[model samples]
Target: MANYINPMEPEIKYNIALLYFNEGRDEDAIKILKECIKLKDNIIKYHRTLGVVYLTNGKHDEGIKEVRTAFKLNENDILTLNNAGCYYAIYTNDLHRAYYNLKKAADGITSNTDEYTKNVIKKNYNDIKLVINKIEKGKPNDSIKVPDLRLLY
Candidate 1:
């Protein structure tokens, strides 16, 4: 096994976990991710991906916890900020926090930022801004719709 040959390579386990997540094997992914984290707790990707996996599996609190850990590890990471925004928007309906995260990510973009990541962050920020504007214009809370991230290829 690759892990047996390179037992210290947490990335190997992390990559396997990502593959399992893409295959919808959430429990398997979680198992390996936890192992990966135990091997190397400081990797932001491990925590971020684990957060996403937990959210997709409806483990809201655990997902938030992982994301919070990632944020603490690197608050300036645009990807983490964008994901935090989307996750809070979709799961917690905490528009304020979501908008803050997305705004930070959008503002942090530079020439080095890839087009796909820029578009995704901008789209999420604009979607949240629209909802906030609607609320500011006296729209009822019942009329507010959570932002959705779909078809962003």
Candidate 2:
């Protein structure tokens, strides 16, 4: 069997990737995520996050591939579905993929959590739901007159 390192080491690398991402250095973020992948090959979060970084940098196909790989590791992840949907909607403009992911996200069951598991509830889920509602209901005719609710949160 391969030797095991502390999982936290790879987690730290993942955090560094997020820092680089926030600094607007997408290339650096990708590098750190890749390193994290080698260290913790089974960590799906690293793959998904790296895919998002790629998407932000306009590497749509690569981003989709990476996120899909992550999903293969964990098929029940709502975040991955949302990320894939956003990539399809915003980057590829592939309404079909967007619809599929958004539908999955909207219908997926989530665990109920108490105080100790508070991380279960996040706004991203809500955001995806809103987008799905928009698509299903059709856009407002006066799009410009509508509020930019995206910045609301």
Candidate 3:
């Protein structure tokens, strides 16, 4: 196994964490992600995935912290922007921040981006736009229901 050969490799650990996460093993994913970060903190995916894991598990504070850290590591990364946008919108109720990030991400999409990714970003952007419109038209924020935030692999 790659992990067996490179036990200390951050990517290997990160991949393992992702596998655990996909398998619905949040605790195991978190543990491995933390270890991967300890092994190499600068890698953005480690923090991003960890943040997503935490957010999905209802650890809002921890998830937000990790997402912020990932942004600090690479603010221009489209995936980071998307994640932050969704996290801010869904968890923090910071529609302004969410709109900003989602807009940037949507605009930054290039030809290299896959169709699924473009669709995801567009959907998030549209959802945020709807929410913003409702608020501008004097709808109560709590009354407006936003859909789940989609994450990029």
Candidate 4:
């Protein structure tokens, strides 16, 4: 509703993009993502969310590329890693990358010891562990530990 670009605070630009996305306005989200790039080009979240926007719009390749860059920047980002992995695993059906990212997510969650965090991880961990068993069982061919972040978000 207001101007997407703030005069300062580069991170807010990303939030604006997210607000656009949460509002179900993909075009506005794209515009804000581009603006975020202009303000601070190195933020991985902007690209990650941009990828999500593109993916939601059915531009899977563009989404994958952008989200992959985000993954490169932050391997532990549940959003980018899981999204890219799922795109590769389910959509494109690239089992290796899918297993890698999903495992990374599952492992990352397990690595945190806080009870609250563990409980949080426990839920998704259980789901992702299913995928892990698939990968460890000498088969990336299964869809078990798919790393769904819908619950996390």
lDDT of 1 by residue, 80-129 (tens): 88888888788878898889999999999999999988998999999999
Candidate 1 local Cα displacement, residue 39, angstroms: 0.5
Best by lDDT: 3
Q: Whose TM-score is greatest here?
A: 3
Q: Alpha-carbon error at 74 in model 2, in Å? A: 1.2
Tell me, what's the RMSD of every candidate? 3.2, 6.2, 2.6, 5.4
Task: Write the candidate numbers in order of decreasing lDDT.
Answer: 3, 1, 4, 2
Full-model lDDT for every candidate: 0.84, 0.67, 0.89, 0.68
lDDT of 3 by residue, 1-153 (tens): 353477788888888998999999999999999999998899898899899899899999999899889999998878889998998898889998999999999998999989998999999999998888888887454587777779764
Candidate 4 residue 150 Cα shift, in angstroms, is 3.4
Every model's TM-score: 0.88, 0.67, 0.90, 0.68
**CA deviation > 4 Å runs, candidate 1:** 1-8, 150-153
Off-target runs (Cα >4 Å) in candidate 4 are 1-8, 110-153
Tens-place lDDT per residue, model 2, 8-49, is 598777887889888998899999999999987888888888
lDDT of 2: 0.67
Worst 10 residues of 2 by lDDT: 144-153
Tens-digit per-residue lDDT, 85-148, candidate 4: 5676657656666657656665675454556545544454455556556668855455554555
Cα lDDT of model 3 overall?
Answer: 0.89
lDDT of 3 at 110: 96
Question: Could you tell me how far off, in angstroms, the CA of residue 88 lies in candidate 3 after the best superposition?
Answer: 1.4
